[model samples]
Target: MTTSLTIAVKRIHDAAAASDGARFLVDRLWPRGVSREKAALAAWLKPLSPSDALRKRYHGETADSDEAWDAFRLDYFEELDAGGEEAKAALFTLDAAAKVGPVTLLYAAKSAERNNALALREWLERRTR
Candidate 1:
């Protein structure tokens, strides 16, 4: 994609302030206490979220960041390669709009340190390159 893709962890409000062009939501589950209209999302990619197992395993903080990342990649591959039809559709929006505007992946999560959005950004970068 010619246009840059920004993946950031933020609440919808923070995303609003930071993202001025195109905004895409990348969470499997919608944030609690948030309405669909309030999300102000251009697109939502639920398939990109961490799997249930991974979430449960690394609910908050954990010792195995590397292992969690590896498992996350495996799960992401399943979303991108195997039964990833929806995943393709989600990513395709960004790919298709490469030249028109900035693309930001908005994630509604508390932990900005480590999460699915970061993993997704890396994975997308590696594959796109």
Candidate 2:
């Protein structure tokens, strides 16, 4: 049977609410100044995050141009497609939780528009369709 998933993206620094449901931190590294207790995460799915090289490359970019964003997303999707067992396990776990109820993907990026969590949510949404 197929299950519908409610995937929402939010900043890790923001206050968590009951509506957030099962919160998963999608950043590979923990957000600065946010304690584990404050994060209130059900799990930190680092394996689902972009590779260090890709992240660093994107960060080095001078501007958040559409071209850069597109490249980042394409590279990120490729990484997800070629990911190994750990990544697969993380995605499986995420899918399981999302199947049961709403899920919020938390990220620490300052830009709400161009973050890995957003890319990941888009990726997941596409696959579910």
Candidate 3:
């Protein structure tokens, strides 16, 4: 039998919902205005986030380009594949949570479509397939 993991992605600034389940903040930096209470996170998995260099290149330099998005996904996947023990532990935490119920990955980016949380959700779903 296979368990279908329900992983949702949302902005940290948005109002938390009951459907969000185990909310994990998958960003390297804390969001500007949200307090710890406001975030109500199950965990802050910084190790699962993209490297600062990759983030800057994507957001600061080539945000509008399609090629950049592709490159970012490729590079980000590589990073996750080659990540350290901390990342592995964080992934394990997410996996454990998913086994119990749903999980929501939270991020601070302005773009609703393109962010590390979405990328990480894709990565997680791919691994489960």
- In Å, residue 104's CA in model 1 sits off its true spot by 1.5
Candidate 3 clashes between residue pairs 3 or more apart in a chain or in different chains: none
| lDDT of all predictions | 0.64, 0.90, 0.89
lDDT tens digits by residue: candidate 2, 7-122: 88999999999999999999989999999999999999999999999999999995389999999999999999898999989988888888778999999999999999999988
lDDT of each residue in 30-93, candidate 3, tens digit only: 9999999999999999999999999888887677687888789899999999989999999889
Model 3 TM-score on a 0 to 1 scale: 0.95
Candidates 1 and 2 compared by lDDT, better number: 2
Give the candidates in order of lDDT, highest first: 2, 3, 1
RMSD of each: 3.1, 1.4, 1.5
In candidate 3, how many clashes are counted?
A: 0
**lDDT: the better of candidates 1 and 3:** 3
In terms of lDDT, the poorest run of 10 residues in model 1 is 2-11
Residue 107 error, candidate 3, Å = 0.7
